[model samples]
Target chain A: MIGEWIRFGITCLLLIAALVGFTAAVIGAYRFGFVMNRLHAAGIGDTLGIFLVICAVSVSSGSFLEAAKAFLIIVFLWFTSPASSHFLSQIEYYTNPHLYRYVDRKIQDGPHSDEKEPE
Target chain B: MSVETAYDYLYTGALIWLSVLILFMLVRSIMGPRITDRLLAINMIGTLVISCIAVLSRLLDESYLIDAALIYAMISFVSVLILAMIYIPVRQTRGKFEKDARKEIRAERGIRGSVTESGSPEYKAGKEAEKPAYEKGNAGLDNGRDTQQDASLQEKGGSRT
Candidate 1:
């Protein structure tokens, strides 16, 4: 009974936190308006926020074994996200430089040309 | 809804918010100032997709989504490594060489240049913009015009090239 209650409480806390983090992330994306930087913020929501929620839910389950399985899955995700983001950021920093530029910077390309042509 | 049923609401709402955030990031990746920005956005998208699959799997009590997420992770990792392996060092040296050449040219000609920007993308684009129109649909026409213009400029200025 105590174990189940503990799991339940943790799960409730996890969900609340997840909701808060997700809300903040969405708002952050709206205000920032850049994809390259926004990607890191999303990773936080999906990996850290979602992982905590999953752990809370798994621990609260009726069957200890089922909860353990959920724990294993959460662990798997926790490890994978960083590995992916690390490589992606590095490769992007190197090879495909154009793909990384912001919208405002692209706009500069047009205005600069106009100023130079001297009509 | 009962306490048990409430999990579904919490989970779904969170997912919806997460998806919207990911979509906005995707838009950024599409219009990144440089290629790196887009690639990083894409990487972020991949990670978000995996997390989305994980959440759906838990909500529905399914296991297959985990496998799909794992595969996505592997593919994204390999793609980034391949891109970096080809791009980094060559540009590092080439960038320095270009800067030195520009300084020398400025000293000799003393054009007292109005715009001396190397980092700007338009500077690179302007090099391409020098090309002329190919009315015959052959790209060679633009190259031909730029070459002629360059030659005439050099001759008038007396052997600058």
Candidate 2:
């Protein structure tokens, strides 16, 4: 009975942590000034927040099948989040005519070229 | 209260908190200035909903809801991708039209016939200074061999950076 109580406590802690992450994400998304900044904020909920919530649910679920399914959601999101973020940023870059005014870009000589190296 | 009853209360509180967060994200999406802003808010909403569903799966002891959450994640990802794909080509063609108009203006002025090799070095330098650094790198890559199409393709790569 004690073991079950311990597990329950741990699950509660994880869920609380997840809740905090989502709350922070929402706050950040609202507070940030730029679209790129907002994307950074939203990413918190996409990766860490979802992962924690799923972990909490999986811990409460004693069945191996259910836990595995929960784990799969995290894995799938790990791949999808970056892809979506990339495409969204691409959309922003291409569509925004005055993007250069807001975003600073640094030009380097080549991929292998270092800042210290002289031309 | 019994431990199970306490757990139930905790779950209920979490659900209410997540629901509030979702509403906040919805407001952000509506008030956002750009398409990307709205898309990002929508993406976040999807994530919050997934978490809510996962919690519900545990709270209600319904295993099928987890599957529903998984499907929701997949659909959210695809929707973002699809929206991006739809927007990109339209932006590119609009850029092409502007380039053509600039060329026509130059032709009428008897300044230059071709898009390539026309601008003076000072003009080129000033234009390069105005452009974003990544665009300057892309312009450098636009050498004698490739045409405007290749240059535009290289510009697409600039967005990734």
Best prediction by lDDT: 2
B69, model 2: CA deviation in Å? 1.1
lDDT of candidate 2 vs native? Answer: 0.76
For candidate 1, the share of real interface contacts preserved is 0.22
Candidate 1 chain A worst ten-residue window by lDDT: A110-119
Using DockQ as the measure, the top candidate is: 2
Q: Write the residue-wise lDDT of candidate 1 on A1-119 in tens digits.
A: 56645554676687667656655654554344344455576567656665665565555444566556556656765676576556556554444323312322344354333211111
lDDT of 2 by residue, A1-119 (tens): 88888998999999999998888888888776667777887886668899889899988888999999999999999999988888888888677754433433224233333222111
Off by over 4 Å in 1: A1-9, A19-47, A60-119, B83-86, B89-161
Please list all clashing residue pairs in model 2, or write none if there are none: none
DockQ for model 1 equals: 0.22
Chain B TM-score, candidate 2? Answer: 0.58
Model 1: per-residue lDDT, tens digit, B114-147? Answer: 2634334665355435333331233344434544
Tell how far residue A62 is off in model 2, in angstroms.
Answer: 1.4
Q: Which ten residues in a row have the lowest lDDT in candidate 2 chain B?
A: B140-149
